[model samples]
Target chain A: MNDAAGKNTIERAEPGEVGIVQPRDFVSTGEFVFESGQKLPGFTLRYETYGRLNPARDNAILICHALSGDHHSAGIHTLADRKPGWWNNLIGPGKAVDTNHWFVICSNCLGGCQGSTGPSTINPQTGRVFGMTFPFVTIRDMVRAQKRLIDSLGIESLYAVIGGSMGGMQVLQWGIEYPAFVRKLLPMATTARESAQGIGFNEVGRQAIMQDRDWNHGDYPKNGGPRVGLAIARMMAHITYVSDASMDRKFGRKRTAAESSTAAYTFDAQFEVESYLRYQGEAFINRFDANSYLYITRAIDHFDLAEAHGSLEKAFEKIEAETLVVGFTSDWLFPPEQNREIVLALLREGKRASYAEITTDLGHDSFLLESEELYEIVRGFLK
Target chain B: MNDAAGKNTIERAEPGEVGIVQPRDFVSTGEFVFESGQKLPGFTLRYETYGRLNPARDNAILICHALSGDHHSAGIHTLADRKPGWWNNLIGPGKAVDTNHWFVICSNCLGGCQGSTGPSTINPQTGRVFGMTFPFVTIRDMVRAQKRLIDSLGIESLYAVIGGSMGGMQVLQWGIEYPAFVRKLLPMATTARESAQGIGFNEVGRQAIMQDRDWNHGDYPKNGGPRVGLAIARMMAHITYVSDASMDRKFGRKRTAAESSTAAYTFDAQFEVESYLRYQGEAFINRFDANSYLYITRAIDHFDLAEAHGSLEKAFEKIEAETLVVGFTSDWLFPPEQNREIVLALLREGKRASYAEITTDLGHDSFLLESEELYEIVRGFLK
Candidate 1:
């Protein structure tokens, strides 16, 4: 998320006029007083909410998303001018998230491009896009910012916090860094600590992004952003989202066309698989800010609760939230064993926890896929 | 394999000397006359040998290699200064496939570089490399060339034919294509038919190659030969070479010095892995003709013995050799199940066969890695 607050102040209101809670236009500022007594500002958080907050404001739920997912988690515009949110399927009047029962709040995380400030955002002091100048943010810092947002909204504690992938990193951090504040924790397809292997794959993607000639040290946004690097990065990442078997079952020996099938002639994105990945990259560039990718991935890499607590068992000792962790068997990027590891450690620590390893071969993307089984688990657990 | 006779124009062999089987100067050709009456020409063959041929020439064994491997299966060569073949760890004096007991022959396949003719060879008729003009060759074609070579050398039945990967493909082909020629077979890390998954991975590699502008429709020899495309291809291949666990164990979440690793800026190679793969691509260009990659891989893709016969069982019915099949437990690219399928089909056909699945975390690369167990198996099987 970008630090939008440090810029020329926008209308500062409770945003409660339209059944809103802190509905400010465009920018919201946040600050951090580090454990070392170092105070840092030029921080901000841009957010959105669905449904009404009860007078008690104790019904708020912080909904988190995976990489590239935005704050559009629910609700279609009543005015017929806006599209339904990304998670509209899961969050609605009577949907699984049950907007009528909870004040659903979803925010574009820090270092994000949507409405929040990120690499593409301007550095107020330098009059340049933040690019690499944006201070490196930690997962703890992101959670701290969210906590401030909640505080500003007059909420004492979150009814629940939910997330997946990097968002799951935040949920875990919220439970550990502010245990009492989170009533329920939901993390899917994530690890307590980004394994060396996980980090290695991310490093390669980051390198591919930075190595692109257009990256120009992140200053390329003014010239149209580093699309090629980002695309290449996305292409590399696209593979991790799918299982080898899936790729074969779909595109096996199937040429995109007669011309592009052979090795000798013009390749021209002819394979069905190649075409699919390119589409993912292109669509991604339109909405995602490359700078945010660096920050968010960095934040994820920084998250090591086990290291922070000196051990996995110790980390779970601090997670007081009733936990519901989910994973897929075919999630190679974050295999279910990671969830089992966390669950086992929590059990060892006598922490309230629930773990379920569903059998699926959708790979890491299973969480995002259309799965009745996954939804049932989420609904039943939350209920 | 290629129809060596059609692929390269030999200036004419000077005849066999005491220690040499006739030297093929200028260009070497090995023709495999197909049953289809399609007489594609310009054949070439690159080969290397080890051990002493008995006076009766009845003690010869053939060593085959996988895709991306060549005739350099043994012996130290001053020109290339490469190691003594890939299986050198398992093949040496008094070792498995011992130099003392049997004469061994390994060739670069017809479409390969090394001393053989391929995309880089000058067409005697056109005085230019065939490039895309090179005809698609098959495993049976490769075997046919070997049969001619064997006939030329006055050897009737070979003591054994041993190989892994594509080499293993040849072994399978030899069992069915000419049942009387080979007396024994050792095929490792291979399947009777290249699976749909295998084809998909290969397609990714081929796409990477064809996407490069310098590839120039296989005419890019002067323009650096699709180095980037080939690198990308190699990168994809590298991922398939090891399991997730091996990657985690070897390079998870670790970063080297900025300039020394992929994390920093550099036009030159950064990260040991990058350097390693770059070296692999550069060295490959020097010794390999890209056209051969096209033709040989096409051959592998074209190979489906079950499709040729009515079924895999029918294909295996002709096998007269004592079979020793080996598979790696973690070789996801050609997993144990694939080899087991082949072994099972052979068993279903009521053939004499032995199988072993070596436990290793090395993934598909186990065939190349040093394994004392493999040595013992080969030595004992031969005895």
Candidate 2:
């Protein structure tokens, strides 16, 4: 660990009880010595269990969220007054990821702006916000941090690890970096290695954040720190995430409010797509930190699963996990071909796997949308 | 002609040289008296002379350009020094719409920022930038203006009126609105109607322009007037003009010179895609007015042949012109189906027509690419 040259006031998540074993809830604590040799202290990991964890604790399922999701998978919770997490529709109350029996956990990934060690956290060495000093994180680093979290919880293995889009990417990373820990895997609407298309989109979003005048080299807490930039970035991503057809059916050329006069060509949400994107950008800044948005998206763009394992095929060589890959038909951002390629890679490794391509115009975000068939497929696959 | 409300200046074209002597390059202008009871100014058409106008003035061709193109037909003369215009490869010498035998005329369209009476032109009544005060122009309105230019030049009919994308829309509009004006019509890589999807993209671009701080609601010339917004708008349009593969091959994850560092992670143009977009945006703004971008793109969004002429078939009812419809294999913006629909419309109208679907991954901008085969197909059809 790096030396504690100058210490001052610091705070972190204290060890807490398991708080009763609910199928979709899991929490634990650990420590991580980062690549920079800086030690992260009292890392509290909060996760939720879904479906059944087979007798061996081998049926344990681990889920990872995108940029702004947290551990409270799907249930009634009294912690800090927020609603039951974002993906609750897909993972709770007899849904695809049922809480009837399986053990599911989705911890806030490392470097996340949430309850994770991030730029918002204070540096023990200097007693100041990590800010620009925070060590760069890779998908491997995040998965490694999760591994420590799982180890601390006394969980040796997982039946399946699932994620989509960025989360789907994390799923691939978990499988590539630590094959033995995963017995099953589902990476939906994602790629083994983000193609040039995915990387290009992410890069643009990152630039939007960093170019904001307030960014100040990622050290601008004194100012608002790139909120508008973050909002623009979010708006661009929102367009890519949803399909054109979906956007058309939902928004169209419909004006924000009913047009009162033909002469009144005012600055308003004249089209449905504009209104939707505006809402998306507005809502994003509320829950996400601009700096964290920049950092994590950069990490995603930097991710290369094939390079991580030295070869694309080699990445899956030792994977014994039964894979259930899901892809949405209209996801041009991370199209079906990307997910199909993932399934092909597993097949090349001669691993047990199943693949389903869902027809939907929800685009890269089809995974996040509610579709009965996708739910049915997941339920059966997990069972 | 309704009172000259506020007369200022009148500079007619050099009488003898500009207009063609043959009747083949002509089309009578349709005058649509405005609600304001004013007879709008007429078109001053300019065209090229080809081999013999076939002794019957029947082989005259009309070429049309996309959003930011002009009347230059072919070659690199001191008078024709606009970088050979957009379709240089397909027009000069013995190429498609060959100047060898077919007289080709490509005029600056109505409501264009390019040396035409568009939104930016000074209104004689106010002696100020017309801006939003300029009358709205439809695709058909442009066709009507061009018709006057053709008639004033002594052309009564054309061998063909050919164009791709927005220009294609004009070809279709001309064939329907003024049947006697054309002998053959080609609508290449264009749709019967601008899809809700395409309109959505345009709307997003417009929003970017309007949202720029310097954009004084289309009246901020002294303030540098929305250059950033216009650049961003161009950036978005550039994405639609190319296929994903093209972007990956050309740009991928290359970084800009300013952002690269031995240690620090740079976001500025770090990806080749970023550099390409920035360059496209910067170059685009140099030649385009910010407000003009808004108006022209909206004109495109509002262009739907079927919307104006009822059914796609009815859209071609009175056309006696032979037609050649063409499409690029990779043009998702206006794919093969769009071109096919135009051909189908002509066929239903019993007008002679041919359709060609060129296989290329150059996307909607394929017509602008160096494709000799595409030129050959067009040349043979025109001949």
Candidate 3:
């Protein structure tokens, strides 16, 4: 059952390395009901774990992921894998979330494509890919699914539940749903609710995907579907992930060497930023399912703590976890104000919550990018 | 040659109405060269004029247009017309532009589609639509062509040149290209150069159009071509035209009455903002040519005065006209800082220039929207 056991080839673990890890699946045959009142007969959650559980089983920490992220987060998938997991910089043997002292777990979100039962998964009843047939999911639904996974692992309580962006949404939901089950919550680069601007961006991305003829009403085979449209969406959304200042510093009017020499204008990517965006879009289509993108983004758009609980303050009334919300200075998507709103709401409820504003030019994706300040904050908050 | 003369059927002009106006086309048979070094054998400019030019022809005011704008600056096309010109509010009799005293002239830009010689026009050499074959255009090329039309009108100097957004680009270009030919300039809601973020947004829009199957490589039949893609582009761009605060105020999680009552999930536009964007996208496809959209946006992407000249100061060094650059407070697309930079450079050059910033939640399109502050700034600058 422990898939990561035999994969550790290193005789001596590197100081910050979690070493090679493998994803494992946990299947539950019990009926799963979504927050939208839709139900599935069963579900599978693919996850990766680091370190080991103590006798008391109370030292577990849950790692939730943002949109487009999944199970593998901290270690190399294989010894030959050139790139480590998405959050390898922070969660390791001696890293911020120190696997040495705490057992860490991260799962592919319920409606995710990375070995999780998502839109691309075959529907058991019809023997066909779920596609749009999959029931609508929400931040609460994602948190509940993770709760089941944690319960199955025999963990009675989580030492901490940490995430950023959509993961941050789940983090907030976890605090509300299982108030007494989680000790600490670290939600970063996210909002208590998706703003109109955020919803507008998501809507544009959804339109781009749906506009493609190849989408075939979300019935296309898993191997192919709306590549162009998905790429367009990704290209546009990627722009929102970084700050204007960061983009200018990185690519300011710099053209591809071949493009700069040509006087004739073509529709091809000319600016370095254009080329980078194109690459991002193309790379996204290779791993992401279009229907899952639609579902996840919709869930994000529908996420409003205030609307769900009647008000922002009421949304956090039951939260017992010590919360630390992180906001980035340049993250216009979920600006500092949005992040602070969560802490303010929690404080208003007389809960143990605080706010941290990181000054950075990385924009919304600041949580994923490496930073000493973020690392320190996460480390101290977890402690 | 005076097309607007017989169109005004109103016995008495309304207070601010310029009344009925007809678009006139001026055909030129002489070679017209583009900044890219390509040449057009001849071209036609569709234009409209309000009021009468004095015998000296010194009271004429040239009105340049933004992207997607045309010659119709004031008045209705006919007595039966339901809508007046795009800028009817600001460019009518006794309005800020004051058609009664200034002999206002507006034109469909050189690379525009509204009755102008553009991609949709039949190419003299090929006897077919130019499409992608249309010569690359620039802000300089547009100013040069407008100069020809102005000279043909027997006007030696313009009392003023006024425009916003892309039109503002033209106003700046006019000051540089014809230093002694324009007495005053009003450029608003524009930038001296497109920012990386601006370029990114434009690139996304372009990608959407090009990705459409019906785009037919910009060679599609005039009646049909990438309508969905064009609409998608318009929807995405519409978001940039407005600010976050404005969008929230206009559409804060408000759904269509029918959508709010439904429980099932679908890709249909549920939010009012989504419906509004879809309408904008649909409306744009009916009036705009995909090829023209490509060409005009390309022209905008290439406009960088600092790059063309050694520096912004150098770009303004030759300008002789008194200038006023206006920026809106909430225009994140081309923020006030960018607008202020133009005047800063002009001041560094010891040029007759100043800047005005109007506080508003209307975003980048504030210049087009009715604002007493903008109107006052324009009127005072003109005086």
| Whole-model Cα lDDT of every candidate shown, in order | 0.68, 0.67, 0.87
Preferred candidate (DockQ higher): 1 or 3: 3
Tens digit of per-residue lDDT, candidate 1, span B253-279? 444455433333222333344444445
Record all residue pairs in model 3 with backbone atoms less than 3 Å apart, i.e. clashing.
none
Can you write out model 3's per-residue Cα lDDT over A1-383, one digit (the tens) per residue?
A: 22232233223467679887778888988999998788999899998888877777878889999888998888887677898888988888878888887789999999999988899999989999999889998989888998988888878999999998999999999999999999999999998888777888888889888879899889997779999989998988998889788988999888877799886666788888888888999999999999999999998988999988999999898998999999999898888988998998898899999999999988999999889999899888887
* A191: Cα error in model 1, Å: 1.6
Query: After superposing candidate 1, which stretches have Cα over 4 Å from the reference?
Result: A1-26, A31-48, A74-89, A125-128, A132-134, A207-232, A254-303, B1-27, B30-40, B79-82, B122-133, B137-152, B193-197, B221-223, B254-311, B314-317
Task: Output the number of the lDDT-best candidate.
Answer: 3
Tens-digit lDDT track of model 2 for B1-383: 00110011011212212211221222234544432243444422333332334445566677777776665544443443446446766765456655556656677666666666666667666778877666666677778777776555456788788888889988888888888878778778887777656766665567666765567677766337767667766776677777777766775555566654433444455655777777877888787877767766766766766755677777778888888888988787887876788788778778798888989877889987878888888777776
Instruction: Report the error of model 1 at residue B185, Å.
Output: 3.0
lDDT, candidate 1, at A277: 70
Every candidate's chain B TM-score: 0.86, 0.85, 0.96
Model 3 CA deviation exceeding 4 Å by range: A1-12, B1-12
Better of 1 and 2 by DockQ: 2
Sliding window of 10 residues with minimal summed lDDT for model 3 chain A:
A1-10
Error of 1 at A161 (Å): 2.5
Ten contiguous residues minimizing lDDT sum, candidate 1 chain A: A5-14
Residue B60 deviation, candidate 2, in Å?
A: 3.0
